[model samples]
Target: ETVNGSEDIDTSMDMLQRQKYHHKRAFEYISQALKIDETQNSEQKEIAINLYQEGINELSRGINIDVWQGTGEKWIKAQRLHDKMQTNLAMAKDRLNFLATGKLSSRRPANLTIMNK
Candidate 1:
């Protein structure tokens, strides 16, 4: 809501660039967190998990951000908007639900058991 030059920003390229920047940052955090194991009696792994969670939150912001697709061949952009919005919205909703409840949803099967003989 407060940034210099933001008042003049009104382009799909700008939106895509911002999205890419956020994605890059989130990926870095995720990669850093992925290299550590929390079960080794090390505090660093816990820190890493926290960092990864934070990165995921940031990634969600990027996914939720409004992006105005530029004027172009309307059909292509329309298809992209439909698919992209569905995927992004689903991810955001799934994360929010998971945060609220430990499980993803009741419909997800919970009775399946892996067995070895």
Candidate 2:
């Protein structure tokens, strides 16, 4: 009898789920910040920025998990979620810089663009 360590898939899936949870939390913070008047909600903005950064950290960790033995679906899902996290992080950094200096940072390429639609 032989035991194939199939726990890796479970672990990877768990990581992806946790990372998605973090991303959702950050999004909620951003939404809350946006709903408030920016003139009087600096504290909320700061909190949102912090949460976004935390989410980015979690995503970084989650995407780095060893998935060599896991299914391609897990890897694909992780990559897609990681990409979304990057965009969200850029938005967060831009907001933080704007709050601090009244300008958007140019460190990251714009993740968003205007559309004719």
Candidate 3:
């Protein structure tokens, strides 16, 4: 029982690390996408968008895996990471919309406008 319990914790930790990695890579892709003017490099923008979308899919899968079995702290940490990923995903979506329409999204809050930068 002790060994099994330890293994579960290890698996949970690994899942958390994987999720974090995906989130970081997504952020990088989004940053690159933001820097490139879609009019100048539409291909690169599309690639970045695809890469970030892949990352988002990975993060979403990790979130769906119920790995937070033991402590509340683990759950809280996972939730925080999930929230950050959601924010990044939203930014990516907004960027896509902006690039497609050449207009900023009016739905985004004022505070997030600053944070997106």
Candidate with the greatest lDDT versus the true structure? 3
1-117: candidate 1 lDDT, tens digit per residue: 223244434454466666667667766765666555324435574566566576676676666556543344432454464455456445544543554454756444453332221
Model 1, runs deviating above 4 Å: 1-10, 38-41, 68-117
Q: What TM-scores do the predictions have?
A: 0.49, 0.58, 0.61
The 0-to-1 C-alpha lDDT of every candidate, in the order given, reads 0.54, 0.59, 0.65
Which ranges of candidate 2 are over 4 A from the true structure? 1-5, 37-69, 104-117
Residue-level lDDT tens digits of model 3 in 1-117:
234577877876787777777666666665655566444676676675665566556556545655446456775787777776767666666766676677878876896878889
lDDT of 1 at 77: 51
The TM-score of predicted model 3 comes to 0.61
For candidate 3, give the lDDT of residue 109: 87
Q: Find the 10 residues in a row with the least total lDDT in model 2.
A: 108-117
Error of 1 at 1 (Å): 30
- Model 3 stretches astray by more than 4 angstroms: 1-4, 37-70, 108-117
Candidate 2 residue pairs in clash (backbone atoms < 3 Å): none
RMSD of each: 8.8, 6.0, 5.8
